[model samples]
Target chain A: MIEVKHLTKKYGDLVAVNDLNFKVEKGHIWGLLGPNAAGKTTTMRILTGYLPATDGQATVADFDVFEQPNDVKKVIGYLPESVPLYPEMTVTEYLGFVADIKQIPKAKKREAIEKTIVTSGLRSVRGRLIKNISRGYRQRVGIAQALIHDPRILILDEPTTGLDPAQIIEIRELIKSLKGERTIILSTHILAEVTQTCDGAVIINDGFLMASGSLEELTASFAVKKAGVHIRLRSASAEASALFKNMAGVKDVRPQDGGFTIEWSPGADLRDDVTRLVVEKDMGLLEMRPLGMNIEDLYLKIISGGMPQ
Target chain B: MKNIWAVFKKETKCYFTSPVAYVVIFVFLILTGFFFHSLISWFNTQSMQMAQNPYYMQQININQMVYSPLFHNISIILLLVIPLLTMRLLAEEKKIKTDELLYTSPISVLQIILGKYLAALFVLFVMLALTGVYSLFTFAYGNPELPAILCGYLGLFLMGAAFMGVGLFFSSLTENQIVAAVLTFGSLLLFWILNWAAFSAGAFWKDTLNYLSFFQHFDDLTRGILDTSDLVYYASFAFFGLFLTHSVLQSRRWR
Candidate 1:
């Protein structure tokens, strides 16, 4: 539903987003994952046609962001990072204003506002001024404003940033409930949010694409590139460590608390040989463990080792 | 057109629901009423003296002595209070960041500007309409020239709109409402006093300053002369201000 290619946004001497490329499929919630100042907000703004990119192309629902901004704006709903809302306006009134601006027909404007109020879980505070509502409800009001026109695409920037833990969970559930028929690009620094809510993610750092794939694919790709295999020993000795290090097809060994962790070259298996040597020498090998790449592991590996080849 | 209406409705609703509209209107009426009472008292005092002489009595027409000067006073009051009406129009939206919602919506920038400009203009209309009671009082108590009073109203309304347009541009230029108000007041004051600078200038510079001065264009209308030049000047001035606001918003998006 959305595609951004070579998107670079520069502000005079500073480049906010550089050579960024990512795609989001229909009906999938994709996280734009990055740390602070990663150009996630800038990228989202560009996609929503709220900001013009310095160079490169971005499209929403087949409309060029640069050439056909209004068309792009029509297809995508944007929740800016601050969750901008008119605090003086009540929830329903705000939604009605959004519906009007989004060009919802007068006949269906009320219906659209009603549906958005429900979808954003803003029913209870619908009559209250946004300023009087809690941050959670205000956030809901912001989302409701974005969803008022029922656009197919939603670009939400840090939708859960300022909420309490319980409120965060509520927002996450709300996002999860918006699962079907909406292509969502939710940006966040929170890694766990992606694991729980996003089907996949385009990970960027310092305006550069670090990795972009489903969870399994991202970890799997990193696993292949970093090392093919790792063996863990509950108890081991210096002799055992030397044996694993010199063993054919073994890459390196890292000794930890009463244990030794071993990694082997890509497409190699030295587990059998290492096991036989430890048994013959009667070295203390309490247990054997295989290292599986999780998200945290992949992220650390990328940060420590630089970009994957 | 629909988008403009949508924006207009939202803005007008904001004004009505808040105390700002009532407070501004109330304050404006009090000031104008004070000015009217004092000017009319002076006019009455002068009329008694002029009553003894035919030529002086003819020189002391109500339109010249009261309504015309009242129109000028109202325009001056408008110059002060219009910033209050317009400072928050775009500046408050930018300060609160609700402008993001408007910018990302399907509505064009031109529509947003027009809708907001018209909303302030509507409040100006309300302010002017309430002052009509003063004219009715004159009609009931004295035989003032009705056409001149009506023409003076037209002049004040158009000039107030022109003030709103300038105020809207300044509002668009800043996110601070105070800054917008100050900038608008300063700019309007500069334009209002341009005619003073024209006094010492040669023919070419004097004519340029006179044409550029906002009150200069308002002069004909207050004289009960509905010249197309005055109408076009006010209309174009309002349009130009909105046009400048549009340009500011569009360029700000790129940044």
Candidate 2:
């Protein structure tokens, strides 16, 4: 539903987003994962048509952001990083105003506002002035305003930034429930969040797209060879570690306190064979699990290694 | 057009629901009231002291022409007050990052500018309406020409609209409302003070500068002459200011 190609945003001498290209298919949440100043926010802004790209093309629902902005805007609901809201307005009034500006019909305006209030979980505090509400509620109100017109796409920038843990969970759950119905581009530094909430991720560093794929795919890209089984047992010596290393599919084994941790060469399946060997040796199979790489490790590898553009 | 109306209504609602509009109106009324009372006192003193001296004295010094000074004085007050009222029209939205919401909405930049401009103009219009009581008092004291009084009020309102247009342009340039207000005031003062240069600059330059002076086009109406050029000048000034404000906002995305 969204396509960004060769998009670059430059602020004077500094490049905020550099030649980034990506496409978000319909009905999937794409987490834009990046560190601070990673150009994630700049990419989101360009996609929302709030900022013009220095050079490139971006579109939403087949409407070019640069040339057909109103069409693109109509299809997308964007919650900016700062969660801009008029402090003096009550929650209900603010949402109503949003509906009006979004051009919801007069007949549907009230219903749209009510639906957004419910969807955003802001019924009780609808009458409270936004300035008096907590940060969490302010965020919910921002989300509500964006969803008031029920746009097909939701581009949320750090929607959970300042909220407390419970509030974060609540917002995350709300976004999760919104999946399958709308295309979402969620940007945040929280890696675990992308794992739980988004189907795919696009990682960028220093204004460049370092990697982009499913969480597992991106994580696996950093692995030189897939991690093997790490076993913890009652009593085992270096001889036993060597024996395990000599087993099929096992490339190297390191002796631990009571067991040996063995790694497998790439494209090798060692699960059943290692279990058979441990069973035959009569060694306690205590614990054996693959040490899957995480986004942190992959992120550091790409950034510190200075991955090519 | 529907988008423009939508923006207009929302902007108007914002002004009413916020204390900014009330504070501006209250201050405007208080200052205009003080000026009106002073003018009334001056007229009363003149009338009492010259009770028996009737040799066309009233016609010679028609300071009793209450509506003219009231409108003229309101325009002067606008120079100070319009900036405060308009400083946050677009700037605060950018500062708080709400400009994204508006800019990404379906409304055009022209719609947003006109919406904000009309909202500020509405507050000024309401202030003008509230001061109608002073005109009633004018009628109570001495009969003034209704056409002249109306012409003067129209001139003042049009001039205030022009000033507000300029304030909106300055507001679009920065995110800080305070900075916008200060810059708008400085620019308005420069235009107001341009007429002073006429004394030193001789007739040719004087007239040239006079055309540029905001208050110059306003003079004919304040003197009870409704010149079409003066009317066109104020209208064009307002149009130009709003157009520039729209362009500034549109260019901001590229910057």
Candidate 3:
């Protein structure tokens, strides 16, 4: 639903977004993962037409963001990083105002607002003034405003930035449930969020697009130095460690957590072989597991001058 | 136009619902009342001979009341109140980062600026309406000229519109509302002081610069002369300010 080609935005000498290229397919949730000031917010702002690119082009839902801004705006909802709201307005009043600004059909506005209030779980406090609401509810109100128009694309910058863990989870679930209905491009520094919420992601750092692909593809692209699998033999001792290390698929073995962890060759399945070896040696098999790459390590590998493959 | 109206309604609602609007209204009423009373007292002290002249006392030269003393007085209040009304128009949006919401909406940039401009104009309208009570006082004691009252309000309305335009432009220039308010007030003060400097330079320069003065144009309106040139000037002044605001917003896309 969104295509950004060679997008570059420069504020005089400072390049906020540089030579960025990415496309968001319909019905997919894409995360823009980056550290603070890594150009994620700038990228989202440009996509939403809040700021224009110094060079290149972007289109949303088939409408050029610059040439047909109103058309593009009609289909996209953006929640900026700060969650801007009129504090004097009540939650419902604020949403109504947004709906009006977005020009949602007057007849549909009330129904859409009700849906947004319920969906964002804001019905309980809809009558309370925005300034009096808690941060979590205020954040929900922000989401509600974005959702009130039922746009086809939602661009959220750091949607879960300030929330506690539980609030974050609640919002994440809310976003996840919205997953196939519209295209979502949300930026965040949280690695686990990308793992749990986004199907595809673009990693950026220092105004550069570091990597972009599906979650598994991103992990696989960085899946160098095949990880080791830890195996424990309840009955076997030091002698069994060497035997397991010498196995055909085993490249290296080390003691960890009172057990042996053996690194196997890539693409090699050793679970069957390890089970057979245990049976032959009469060493009882305790646990056998393949180590997976965590998001933090992958994030570091993508950003911290690590290999860009 | 519908979008403009939508924005206008929202902005007006914001003014009424917020404490800022109430505070501005309360302060505005107090200041205007003080000025009105001072004008009447100043007239009272002008010697009973002049004050008792039925022509001077009965009609009360609305031109003097509205154009000369009171016009400038209201201009000073405009310096204060217009900024308060306009400081939040665009600056608050930028500060809260809600400009993103407005920018990304289907509304045009002109609609946003015009909507905000009208909202500020609405407050000025309310202030002008409240001043009617002062006019009623004159009508109670003497035969007031309805044409003078209408003309006086016309000039005040146009001048206030121009001030709103200036304040709106300042609001667009900064994300800090305080800075916007301060800068707008300072700019209006500079305008207020410009004619004095022009006059001190002597007649040739004065005649040339007088045409450029907002006060000169207002002075004619207060004297009850419906000079088309002065009317045209204030309208152009307001339009130019709106045009400047539109350009400022357009330039934002580049930044």
Candidate 4:
């Protein structure tokens, strides 16, 4: 539902977002993965029509961001990084005001506010002032305001930044529940948030798009060829290491305190070979397992420009 | 239009929810009341002297002595107080970052400006309406010219609106409320004394200073003259201020 083409935003000599290109498909949750100052917020602002792109184009829901900003704004709900809110207003009152500004019909405004309050799990604090609420509840109110209009696209900048562990989990669950219902583009530096809640991710660094794909595709495409195996053997000696290193597909073997670690090439299942070698050499094999790459490893590899395949 | 109304209602509600509106209105009414009481005492003394001496035939116009000065003092008070009403309009939003919500909304810049401008004008209208009690008192015991009183109020309202527009523009220029308030006060004071330069300057400079003086235009209205030029001046002054405010808001997108 969103397409950004060579988007560039410059402030004098500083480029906030440089030649960034990405597209988000409809009904998919895309996580914008980047560290602080990675141009994620700038890119989101341009997509939402909040800031003019210095040299590029973006469109949302088929409306050009520069040419038809009003139309684009109508279909996209944005929650800025700061969670802009009127502290003096109650949850219901604030949502009501947002609904009014969004031009929901007068007859349906009340219903819309109620639905958003419930959706964001803000019904309990509906009557309390926003300033008096907890940070988690405040974030929920921010989300509620964005959802009041039921826009097709939701752009959230760091939706779970200041929350505690449980609050973060609650927010992640809320966002995960929203998957497949709307096109969601959320930016976060937390690798787990992307893995837990998003179906796809766009990794960026220094205002450059490093990688973009589904979670599995990103991990698989950025996977390293070498795999490490940890083995505990009764007979941990030089002969054992030599025997393991001499086996087919085994690249290196290093002895440790209790056993040794073996490195091998990809697409080679050396578990049976190592098992038979250990049995034949009379090296009692206590344990042997293959280490797989997690999202954090994939993210680090992509950010460090070390993608193997 | 609906967007304007929504913003207007929200802004007006915000004014009442905070202490700024009540404090400004209360202080304004108290100051205007004091000025009205003193003016009425002076008028009473002048009338008493005239009643004692039958040979004194120069009649004093009650509108001139009472209502004219009353409106004039209120206008000055508004000059000092309108900034307080308008300082938080746009500046506070910028400080708190709520301008993101406003700019990202589908509403146009014109609607936001008009909504805020009208909300401030409505607060001033309510305060002006409260001052009407003084006029009712004059009608009970004295004969004041109704047309002259109406004209005085018209001038005060228009001048207040013009000042509010300028204050709103300054509010848009900064995120600091104190800076916005002080700048607005300074600008209004400069306009208040624009004609002061006429005494030291030559003909061309003197006429230019006098023509630019807001007080000069207000003087003719206080005397019950409904000059179209003065009306157009106030209207255009407000328009110019709002236009600049719109430009400032639009320029923010580029930044």
Candidate 3 docks at the CAPRI level of: medium
Candidate with top lDDT is 4
Expressed as tens digits, the lDDT of each residue in A1-309 for candidate 2 is 988899999999999999998888999999998888899999998998888999999989999999998899888999999887988888988887788889899999999998989999998999999989999999999898888888899999999999999999999999999888899999998887898899989988888888888777776776555668778865576667878867876788887667777888767778888888778888777887775556766766676755554
Clashes by residue pair, model 1: none
True contacts kept of each: 0.78, 0.81, 0.84, 0.76
TM-score of chain A of 3: 0.88
The CA lDDT at B161 in model 1 is 88
Off by over 4 Å in 3: A225-228, A231-240, A246-249, A256-259, A265-268, A272-288, A291-296, B41-68, B200-204
Candidate 1 global Cα RMSD: 3.7
| TM-score of chain A for the candidates in order shown | 0.82, 0.87, 0.88, 0.89
Candidate 2 local lDDT, residue A43: 93
Residue range A1-309, candidate 3, lDDT tens digits: 889899998988999888998888999999999888889998888888888889989989999988888788889888889898888888988898899888888899889999999999997999999899999998898888888889889999899988999999999999998877899999999888999999999999888888898988887877655656777777658888888878887888888776787888778878788789888998877888777665568798767867453
DockQ of each: 0.65, 0.67, 0.72, 0.76
* Interface RMSD over true interface Cα atoms for each candidate: 1.2, 1.5, 1.2, 1.0
**Pick by DockQ: which candidate is best?**
4
Positional deviation of A174 in candidate 3, in angstroms?
1.5
lDDT of 1 by residue, B1-255 (tens): 999998998899999898989999999999999999998999989999999999897787888888888888889889999999999999999898888888899989999998998889899999999999898878887898888778889989988888899999999999999999999999999998899999999999999999989879888788788888888888898889988999999997667
lDDT of 3 by residue, B147-170 (tens): 876887888889889888888998
